[model samples]
Target chain A: MSIRYAILGFLSANPLSGYDLKKLFEESSVFHWSGNNNQVYRTLVELHNEGLVTQEVQQQADYPARKIYTITEKGLAELRQWVLSEPELPQIKSSFLVQLAWADQLEADALDDLLRKYDAEIHDQLIVVQEHKRRSKTSPQRTPREAYLWEAIMDNKILYYETELNWVRTVRETLNEMGKDK
Target chain B: MSIRYAILGFLSANPLSGYDLKKLFEESSVFHWSGNNNQVYRTLVELHNEGLVTQEVQQQADYPARKIYTITEKGLAELRQWVLSEPELPQIKSSFLVQLAWADQLEADALDDLLRKYDAEIHDQLIVVQEHKRRSKTSPQRTPREAYLWEAIMDNKILYYETELNWVRTVRETLNEMGKDK
Candidate 1:
């Protein structure tokens, strides 16, 4: 159901083919909020069948005609309704925390290895987020609100990465001290 | 499997009854985690049967003897393995986006109402996250790393809330302009 809105939101902005949507999602930091080719294609078909979007088959010089989707008036209304509606609260079902809750079962050596892995993964994420921040700057028409929103989002991402790194280091030190006690 | 670790982790930190463990999760934002009594009791029974935790009966002054659980070495070993391993990345699945994708089904007025609902919810979440930050500061013994880690987690929560709020506002303005065209 959520995927339905995602497609509408994109089409509301501009007409696009399912392939174009997939490309945008993968190539952008917004990839975090993305769908696969199958989802995009299926939804486009559904929307076209429902008359929410009008599809035009345009021939390419060297390829098969593409089915491009544009939002219909009814579709725009639906999109507007969705944009205004309250978002459902996200649920956290992290498997990482589940593992952490049972960390006492781990040997000191294994715990150290785990902490290291967490550190590295967080570091990698930090790099990706930083790159996203850099890319956002290329768009010249961003409003003040959009600027602040992106800043807040990037700051939060960086903060999480930094925090996780700190936690791993702290745990590593604590484990080392325990080893000395033995 | 996740529930098993949560029970074992709590026992590893200190011997606790099923009721006590439930209280701990509720009392602290340690994991921003939660569960009901039914789930708690069921996990405890499972862990006991698995020999991951040993239970001791302790009599209280005016109540039935409580069963306290302590983590077994075997449980600790299992927890260590989970911590060391890399977990599968969590995918973001949002219904709001789906609603937008199918927006052509809705009326203009309906769309506006949805945006207002989103605005109110984001504001509400922002208040809760801010309050949680203020309340967390009462604990003085936390290390700089722990403090940063906690702040970072809150920052992420706040960031997402702000992002949705800004998006709603922008979409609303766009809808208004499009209305004028009609």
Candidate 2:
């Protein structure tokens, strides 16, 4: 449902082909909010079926024709309604945390190894988020208000990763201290 | 898959009826990693069918017969294997964040309203997490190591909510300032 609205929200901005939507999602750092290619295409079809969105096929010279999607007025209204509605609590499902929950059964070395591996993964994610932030800032053509909102979203993403990295470090340090006592 | 391992981990500790598992999930702060009653029962059946767990029917005098689920040796092995495996990146899906991403389309007051509503939601979640932490600490019978791991998990959850609440406040403040400027 959120994915449906996310697509509608993007289409409300401009008509876009599936490829264009995917590119926009990646470029705008909305990929996290989007489904994979198949899911996106399927949702577009569903939206068209529901009259929430309309599609037009564009002829190409040599390449295959592209089906462009445009959000209908109903879709725009639904997106706005969703945006104003009570926010659903995001389902938390951290597999890393799940491992940590049961880590007491693991040996200290193994646990330390797990933490370090997770730390590295988070570090990489932090880098990706940083890059996204940079791209968001340098991208031109947005209204000041739009840029402000985009920055706020990017800032939130950046801080989320930074917080995770810090937590990982704290846990690692604790594990190290525990290792010394054993 | 994470839910399966979480259930297996709990069952490895002790046999539990679906009701017991659901209660423990809420009490132990593993609810985020678990599903609802239907999912729990269905997964238990799946596990039983897969020979990873076995169910024993206990006839109750006043209530319906309870099916107590016990993890098989295979289940324990699988749980351990999963815990030791590389952790998958948790997918991020915050409807609040999604709304914020497109919030430039909304009026200042509407955006402010949205942020305030989200803030209240996070506040409620923070209270739930804190209560879960207190219960985790007060509950007895865990070994020192088990307690340590539990504390770490609780700490992660607490910090996550705290960070989110702080971020929400920051966003609201910025929104207010934007409103003032406008």
- Which structure among the candidates has the greatest DockQ? 2
Tens digit of lDDT per residue, candidate 2, span B1-182?
44788788778778889998777676655446443788788889899999999989999999999999999989888888888999766666677777776677788888888888888887898898888787764233256767777777778778877888898888889778877876
- Candidate 1 chain B worst ten-residue window by lDDT: B137-146
> In candidate 2, which residue ranges exceed 4 Å CA deviation?
A26-34, A137-141, B26-30, B137-141
Q: Write the per-residue lDDT of candidate 1 for residues B1-182, one digit (tens) a residue.
A: 35566666566667889888787667544344585788888888887788878889999999988998888888777755555678533333445434443343456677567667767876897787778767764223234433443454455456556666676687778676666766
- In order, the first chain's TM-score in every candidate is 0.82, 0.89
Which residue pairs collide, candidate 2? Answer: none
Compared with the true structure, what per-residue lDDT tens digits does model 1 show for residues A74-149?
A: 9877766655566665443445544544444456677567667767776787788788777764222234433443
Once fitted onto the true fold, the runs of candidate 1 whose alpha carbons sit more than 4 angstroms away are A31-34, A137-156, A170-182, B1-83, B87-182
Instruction: Tell me the TM-score of model 2.
Output: 0.92
> Would you estimate the TM-scores of all the predictions?
0.57, 0.92
